[model samples]
Target: MAVKVSSQKDTYKATAVFLVLMGVLYLLDKWIDFSDYNLDWVMQKDTMLLYAAVTFLWFKSDKSVGLILAGIWLIQNIALVTALLGQVSTYLLPLTLLLIGVLLYWLSSK
Candidate 1:
């Protein structure tokens, strides 16, 4: 049907946008020096946004896959995130945001 075709097209468009976003973010993270300006928080926040976008997309396709990907993302980012935290209690905010991202994907999953 036309609706399904349009929906698939939209999905493809979203995917392309997401890929572009990831590429830009990766380049910024690798090539730029946010820490030099005490802007590391900005990079961390962008990382969260990237994960959220990926999780949301995966969730729309498959809930189990979304959860799995979220878990894998968390595991992979743990060390750098911990170092980013730089303090015990400060870990709560970012970790909570990541968990909330996972939860949002789980809840919005279809």
Candidate 2:
């Protein structure tokens, strides 16, 4: 009973911190110029929301949810993420798939 109450309180605290961080990031994005740095994508609304969601989930003990969300975000923004990798981006999908397969096999063995 006490553990559940503490967990709920921690979750509320995490939620408040997440909201504050998101608000600060949103304000910074609007007030600053990131175009020259080629980092405007980092300040985009969707990106910020995804980051906040991942952080919130991880802090709330929902690590798998955070990982899955982060993975989805990476897939959705792979082009942006690998923009500097050039040709390397082309092999990312297969490499990622292979890694996932290896992870599954290792987990199953465990």
Best by lDDT: 2
Model 2, position 95, has a per-residue lDDT of 93
Lowest summed lDDT over 10 consecutive residues: which window, candidate 2? 60-69
| Backbone clash pairs in model 1 (N, Cα, C under 3 Å; residues 3+ apart or in different chains), count | 0
Count of steric clashes across candidates, in order: 0, 0
- Best candidate, TM-score-wise? 2
- Segments of candidate 2 deviating more than 4 angstroms: 1-7, 29-39, 105-110
lDDT (10s digit) by residue, model 2, range 43-63: 776686587666767677645
**Model 1: per-residue Cα lDDT over 14-87, one tens digit each:** 56666676678668868876687787765575465556557456534434434555666666677776777678
Model 1 stretches with alpha carbons more than 4 Å out: 45-47, 50-110
Task: Give model 1's TM-score versus the native structure.
Answer: 0.40
